[model samples]
Target chain A: MTVEVDVTIKPKRGVADPEGENTKKALHLLGFRNVRSVKSMKTFRIELELDAETTGDAEEEAVTSAVEEMCEKLLSNPVIHDYEILIVGRQIGN
Target chain B: MTVEVDVTIKPKRGVADPEGENTKKALHLLGFRNVRSVKSMKTFRIELELDAETTGDAEEEAVTSAVEEMCEKLLSNPVIHDYEILIVGRQIGN
Candidate 1:
């Protein structure tokens, strides 16, 4: 089974958003005044291949747990980014 | 009223996925072969300011339609990328 995870990472509110600020400034310069603000985000879609078939909730639970661990350990920087995860399972490559 | 739109853009399948390939190679170098594949996506959160209070469905519809126009005209490149849109309304600056 393969588990696909969509993780969106963004800077928390009140954090310094230089990229957002720069984009907003450019928009204002371009006369898009109603564009009050913007926030930039990075989204990663990861596919994890596992040996076990997802026959029950237990297998699904295990994959999600492993994905969460990957997030904490490598995918996201906990101090600077807040990440949201969406997971789904499918056959080998489709 | 303030409208928030989240857009996710990616190249269509069968079109090259260079970023995905690079990331996959790096992951393999780190011994994560269970990572069958990966895809990179960019998510932009845009905030639109409008004078009208979102009192009814009409106001909300107007904002989303306007946002869609922005997407078509400025945000995503039509030929090489596919985009998804999400819209929400919030109070003045919160």
Candidate 2:
């Protein structure tokens, strides 16, 4: 089975988001007065090949663990960012 | 009412994604052979203030129009990138 995950990395609340701030300012300058705030984030769509025989809770645990490890090691910075992982889709026999 | 929209900007299917490539390579080096592919994207969580009285289809249309206009004007590059918008959550009042 192949598991597809979406990992969204966002700045922790109260952390500085200079890019978002700049974008908000630019939007305001452009006349979007109703715009209140903007928070920027990064997302990764990842496909992982699990054993074709893997299924049920075991498969879910395996995929979640692998994805979380990947996020901790390389995908996101733990210092100021928080990440959320969702198993969006799955393909069988891949 | 205030509408929250999540705009995801991703590289088009055939477009080059150096960041994704590098991440994939890095994961491979880190011994994650199960990683098939990775696609990186940018997301903006935007908060827009609509008229307090606006609701139903009209409110939805208004938010969609405003967000699309923002994307076209500054948020994303349409040439090499494609975007998806999702209205995840909303608040009753500003």
Single out the weakest 10-residue window by summed lDDT for candidate 2 chain B: B85-94
So what's the TM-score on candidate 1?
0.75
* Candidate 2 segments whose C-alpha is farther than 4 A from its true place: none
Clash list (residue pairs), candidate 2: none
The candidate that achieves the highest lDDT relative to the unseen native structure = 2
If scored against the real structure, what TM-score would every candidate get? Answer: 0.75, 0.94
What DockQ does candidate 2 have relative to the true complex? 0.91
Let me know the DockQ for model 1.
0.63
* Pairs in clash, predicted candidate 1: none
Per-residue CA lDDT of candidate 1, range B15-60, in tens? 7788778877877776677888888877878888777555467766
lDDT of 2 by residue, B2-94 (tens): 889999999998999999899999999998899999999999999998888888888888988998899899998999988888888789965
Q: Model 1 segments beyond 4 Å from truth?
A: A50-60, A88-94, B51-60, B88-94
